[model samples]
Target: MKNVIITGTSRGIGFEMVKLFSEAGHNVLALSRNSKPVSDLKLKNVTALEFDIANEPEVVNLSAYLQKAMKTVDVLINNAGFLVNKPFAEITAEEFKRSYGVNVFGVASLIKTALPFMKTDGHVVNISSMGGIQGSVKFPGLSAYSSSKGAVITLTELLAEEYKETGPSFNVLALGSVQTEMLEEAFPGFKAPLSATEMAEYILDFSLSGNKFYNGKILQVSSTTP
Candidate 1:
């Protein structure tokens, strides 16, 4: 069984991934700002870590903790992210910085910390959004969020290329409006979004396939393909 590290596991998509992976017999390290409410099924091989991903000290401590734990991670899911749904004109500098801090910098920090423990066949999945792929007319308030996700997509591609010769695979999954708390916070009444469980299953399947053909590319999963 693979040992996986998943961020943003307090709720939504990350939580679902932790549950699914644990049930599939994978050792899961679930990290979030708050402690995850434990379920009976998660007690077997799931370890929940509570820390702020945006805090450099916390991330450093996490790295040291992992080193002491002596468990090599087979996969790292860069799933912790934040969104600010405000128009560009009204967006504050602090808001933009906060968004980037969590969405971009946090991922980079975690990857750096986890890279040493990753084996040759390891996988890294950066969860991006369809907004990162193309301009969104429907969500003009999400300029900051979209731009941050776009950066994640670019980083994912660059890392994939950098690791191409190194054997480990990296890819970006540009999800199309998955129904999660983040989505609800962004667009409260939005309909037709893919469910969290659906997206989790898709991610699990993709990661287990051992396919590197989609490396460095943004893979979009949506309810309605256009």
Candidate 2:
């Protein structure tokens, strides 16, 4: 019965999450640059919107949509991410900017927009990567991607602290490799331990109830090392 907002819903985890939430009888606003996939699903409770989080104007439009279609958001999952797999020495400034634009800045802007529409019981979940965790296992050619995700983890903590009294808990999840198209695109032939649906189901449950016990924390949901 809750209104949920999910970004990066064109495919993979975000796509599965939309279906899961809708099947669970919740309303979902699925946002992705390419909305056709979700739109084609035609779920009664899911509304797919063509969204580019990297675009500030689109974020403002999202705010307007929230005001018109939903009075409040029960869950805001910042699942949209941009990854640039390039060696640090060779990574360009534009590449870094594109990475941060979607992974960090977009998450921040979306969270800020959602804050006014979020209640005390709402949750804001920022999706990060195990590579983003300090002291965790690192991967080569992920300087821009991993660093931006790291920034999101820190940003989540600060936001949680700033709005502790007002409520709407903020948390970040540092996930291990999942068998997603993003993974395949980034690293061909690599197989992850979990599937997109499995990971999506875990995240769906956490988004609904994790705020009750945790906030301003980074939960590494990985079978991998620290």
Candidate 3:
């Protein structure tokens, strides 16, 4: 079973992914700003660590902790992200910086730290959004978030090409509106857009296959039945 590192595991999709992967018999290193609530599902092969993803020191400390624990990360899931819903014209510098701080810089920092521990046949999955895709549009207030996701997609593609000769694969999962706390925070008073469990299941299945078809591509999943 693969040893995977997932960020933003305190709740929502990241939390569900930890459960899904651990239940699949994989070792999971779950990271978040807060400790995950105690649960039977978190016992055994799943270990949770609390750290601010936006902080460079915390990311470095986490990397060192994993190394000291003699854990090799076979898969790195850059899942920690944030959304700021405000019109582009009204978005403040602080808002834009915070958006990129978590979505882009934090993800890059974790990947850099984990790359050394990753085996030749390892994998890296960056959790992006459908908003990153070309021509994809969202609520007018989501300019900053959408832009950051777009950057993620670009980073994924560049990394995939850079690691083409390596045995490991790099991919981006451009998720459709998934029901998570982030969604609720972004659009208050709105119903869930998609079930987190269903999306997590699909992601787990895709990750286990170790296929290259999705490499450097955006894989979008939606619950909306057409």
In terms of TM-score, which candidate is strongest? Answer: 2
Q: Order the candidates by lDDT, highest first — what do you get? A: 2, 1, 3
- Winner on TM-score between 1 and 3 is 1
Q: Is candidate 1 or candidate 2 better by TM-score?
A: 2
Candidate 2 at residue 189, lDDT? 92
TM-score for each model:
0.93, 0.98, 0.91
Of candidates 2 and 1, the better by lDDT: 2
For model 2, the stretches where C-alpha displacement exceeds 4 angstroms are none
lDDT of 2 at 157: 96
Q: Model 2: which ten-residue window has the lowest total lDDT?
A: 217-226
* CA displacement after TM-score superposition, residue 60 of candidate 1 (Å): 1.4
Q: How accurate is candidate 2 locally (lDDT)?
A: 0.94
- In order, the Cα lDDT scores of the candidates are 0.82, 0.94, 0.80
- Of 2 and 3, the candidate ranking higher by TM-score: 2
lDDT tens digits by residue: candidate 2, 74-107: 9999999997777899999999999999999999
* Model 2 root-mean-square deviation: 1.0
C-alpha root-mean-square deviation, each candidate: 2.0, 1.0, 2.2
Clash count for each candidate, listed in order shown: 0, 0, 1
